[model samples]
Target: MNKKVLLVPLAAMTLSLVGCGEPDVDYTDNTRLTMRVHVDEGSEEGNGYKEIITAFNRENNGKIRVDLEFVARSGGIYETQLDNDKRKNTLPDLFTFDAPKCAYYAKNGYLYDLSSSFSTTEQDNFVALNRYQSKLFGIPIQESSAGFYYNKDMFNRAGIDVSGITVDNPWTFSQFKEACAKLKALPGLKGAVDMRLDATADETATYLLYPFIYSCGGSFVDSTGLHALNYFNSANSKKGFQFLKDLLDNGYTGTNYGAQDFFTHQVGMYLSSGWTIPELDNHVKWGQYFPDRNSWGLLPYPKADDGTAVSCNGSWSYAIGNNPRTDKSNVVTLLKYITNAKSSKVITQHTGMIPANKEAQVGYANPGSAEDVLLQQLNKTSVQRPETVGYAQFSSAFGRAIKYLKDYGVDKSVDDAAQYLEKELSRLK
Candidate 1:
């Protein structure tokens, strides 16, 4: 058995060793180094990370010792904590950050460019590595993609056949609406779908909903990565938002529903990510509504009449801070080790997330399985959120637009939302 590592308080390690190694050091150095890694506390993902760190510490023994530290992760708490650390110049040697924040952190000089840490071939193995200004700033801990989860039993009873649907040949917007009409007419279901509108208050809103815009040929910004006026408010963008509003107008789905409505058979479909698998597989109430995993199936995101299928992608990642006192080589070693194929596989198995390492994704190779559906969409059809320093503001603007569509109706909402996005973009300038 491996020896245990004692947890360290982030406050205790505020003063990182400065000027010890100065700038870059040899990547192969075997120096005895002490490091601290900070991750969000209280999550299954966190547990998986702890396991990786413990195994790493045991393997390296006295040559390298890493202490794990946890900080609050919900309701902007984690972002606030990191911001405070930045101001104090007490950031940890290495830390976890959301992929969308890559530009913000790198532009602020809080992160070190890791482009040289891995060769081109090795870097290609990761599905998504956070980059800014052509420099790699963070490596993905895992990858993510979202799709519609349908109750197979519900579809069967509603006389809907989804057997022919797939990432390449997904349902069109009209077909999806027709299916929703049929499913909502079934007995016992409150609605045809649960879009999880409650997620609007956080990043989950943008992560899951942005694909709608893409499916309809809408973009948040232009090629220059600096504007959202016509791009965000274009005719195509309005069509997508209008489709969502039509669903509400037709009473196919609503803002009010239990978070587990889909799992409990209260809704025919749920828009969610791979993270929902663990709950569906092991929830205490699983036996009540779902007899087995076969009771449900995964569906790719629907496309517009003239567009192709699309889904959202990205997740949290590990990044090295620009603390000159810390040994760059040591932190890079820890980053590569924890995100390797073996370590990634372990985390994916524990969290139901897709692994960042392509090699680690072998576990999902079973064709036509639910897990396989997600993996296929991730590899083939998913797109990343805008990688801009202004992404946070853009997400907020889009989220508010969603709410407006539901409350004030479509045309005004689309125009109003686009105007808001324009205003936010101007502020970023």
Candidate 2:
């Protein structure tokens, strides 16, 4: 467990900004530190990052200028792309990535260890998923909550009242399934769909499915040991997998689970993230594409087999990439600006994501509103993905397992899939 050393003279010295309230050092040098920021440029989130950078540069007045390096997501993929760039000594000065990646990146020296970045008091103010062990790498810039979104018009027409389904009296998985059946029986109504918009993407499938498994009393990783083999195929996990298979086998979901179809009354319950709140709030329409628009209903994910309600709480995070050529001070300053409460509020507002700042959330989340529910789950019952260094591999493997179950209902092939995942993760040890 030896740490991989990057050997940059001043790279490890991050500016401690807690109560210092300033960027630690003023630039009489004002050398116009031109840092390269790598981002998934073709994406909406990437565009949001671009907007933040433009604003930051304007505010700083040429002290720091960022050249957005539009990295295509095709080459080698997450962490692999960064790893490849690192091997060539061409890594960008900064990159935005998933929060779960800090474990892998920090352990192997792909990131600067940020132990000095936040004071103990500031650490307390941070959301739960941002801190990892003793060395923090990724700062959770934006977070999200996944839940069941039902069409209120459909529910009322079906003579079903979902008005009382509060955080305290949420639906159990079985109860939710039964309700979906009743809703499905209504003329022209289809059953619920998985929250993940894309059925084939590995990351979304596994991310959306974990809450069900955790609610059923199974975990994908034993955090104490950071291992997957012994836990992923447990009995409760099988029960959870069976539930997913049932969703597919009974013809409950497919393409129409999307926003447009749900808005048009083609679907009953739409399971997805809190990002839908704004659309519902504004009564969004697709240029006469859909005939009906009902106010959407939000509820926490259905209760598990054991009645333990759970929510997936994680976000896209930013990391200081290893770059010997860039000014370490400037890079850290940008990181501070990107994650501080003010910058975080701007990013969340521009990107339509939930803020990681505790105080900032209170300003946006009205009492008992959809935003309020999302904040409550993120703070209370959220289960973050395991912080193992093998997370990228684990997510891909688990995603494949889900696809296997979808392609061919939970059969003997699933046992083989579990074995493959276990073997893949064991190599990391």
Q: What's the TM-score of each model vs. the native?
A: 0.87, 0.79
The deviation in Å at residue 172 for candidate 1 is: 1.6
lDDT tens digits, residues 1-429, model 1?
A: 333332243434543544333334233444533333334445776788788888999998877777677775657677786787677666667788889988889988889889988889979998778888789998888898888999998899999999899887889999999999999899877999988766777777678888888889888777545577787778888888888888988889888878979988899999998877766777476877876788888898998889867888898888887754445887888888988999998788777788889999986658897778888898888888886777887788778878778888766776777777777767666
- Residue pair clashes in candidate 1: 17-325, 18-325
lDDT digits (tens) for residues 139-188 of candidate 2: 77788887777776677777777767766667777777777767777887
Determine which window of 10 residues in candidate 1 has minimal summed lDDT.
Answer: 1-10
Highest TM-score, which number? Answer: 1
Report lDDT (Cα) of residue 407, candidate 1. Answer: 85
RMSD list, candidates in order: 7.4, 10.4
